[model samples]
Target: MVANNTGPKIQQEKATVSVMIYLYCHQNHHTPRNQLCNECHDLLNYAMARLTMCRFGEHKTTCERCPKHCYRKDYKQKIKQVMRYAGPRMIIHHPIMAFRHIYKNLLSK
Candidate 1:
């Protein structure tokens, strides 16, 4: 996986994405803990691939702030839906990651 060659930042971003997707799947699809429905699983894989091939690599900003858009329009909308549902809940379900993401965004600005 490209994650093996990436820096800590990229790995952490991957973890955050994973958590978001998990939360989304769990709530929306009524998935079991630590499991994803088929559609969500596909989305997670797609998101990971996009992140792996990210042009900015370790120095990349959050997808929302990036100058270039890498995701296809449909997948982009799907991810946006996932993020919208999962973002606020991160503070409750995964506080540390949520705060770290917020902190990283603040520093990037």
Candidate 2:
């Protein structure tokens, strides 16, 4: 994929996943450093991989509204849990990205 097409989506996914990890880890698990535990890290990597392989690339819709669900069953559930937990928190913690994400979803519909 072209960098132009992939860059923003990749960055958005990174930010979203980062927020999810922060919330999920702080509440449920203890880590030595400000880093995700192995499970969350794996989930993040899986999310990134899915973003990279997205068929729509630059023109992609939000994954939630996408017609094709690319994630496997377990990973899909995990990601949904993350997004459900982090989506509202993002407005408080990362307002700009959260607004952009919400706007994008609105436009996609």
Candidate 3:
């Protein structure tokens, strides 16, 4: 199968994930918005790159639930922490994107 390029949907989801992680880091780690600490910035950059490189494209599931593992172990742990801390908060802070993410994952399953 030809690999699909990342599309707007994936881009939007990546943006939402970045925002969620940023919010979590800001609150818990006291990082500034203009400058995420090096680790968090690296994580965000890595996640965005992974999202862009994802083979499943539009059919991609939530990374946590996905059968295909993409992130390295250390990055995976960091992302898990970010998601765990910010996932629920996304419902409040980014209702539409959050609901869409949940709905997409459920449907994909």
> Each candidate: RMSD to true structure?
2.3, 2.7, 2.0
Question: Over the full model, what C-alpha lDDT does candidate 2 score relative to the true structure?
Answer: 0.78
Better candidate number, 1 or 3, judged by TM-score = 1
Q: Please list the C-alpha lDDT of all candidates, in the order they appear.
A: 0.90, 0.78, 0.84
List candidate 3 stretches off by more than 4 Å.
1-4
Candidate 2's C-alpha runs over 4 A off are 1-5
Clashing residue pairs in candidate 1, if any?
Answer: none
All candidates: TM-score: 0.93, 0.83, 0.88
Predicted structure with the largest TM-score when compared to the true one? 1
Cα error, candidate 2, residue 17 (Å)? 3.1
Candidate 1, 27-65: lDDT as tens digits: 999999899999999999999888888878888888878
Candidates sorted by TM-score, best first: 1, 3, 2
Two-way TM-score contest, 2 vs 3, winner = 3
Q: Find the number of clashing residue pairs for candidate 1.
A: 0
Q: Which pairs clash inside model 3? A: none
With candidate 2 superimposed using the best TM-score fit, by how many Å does residue 79's alpha carbon deviate from the native?
0.5
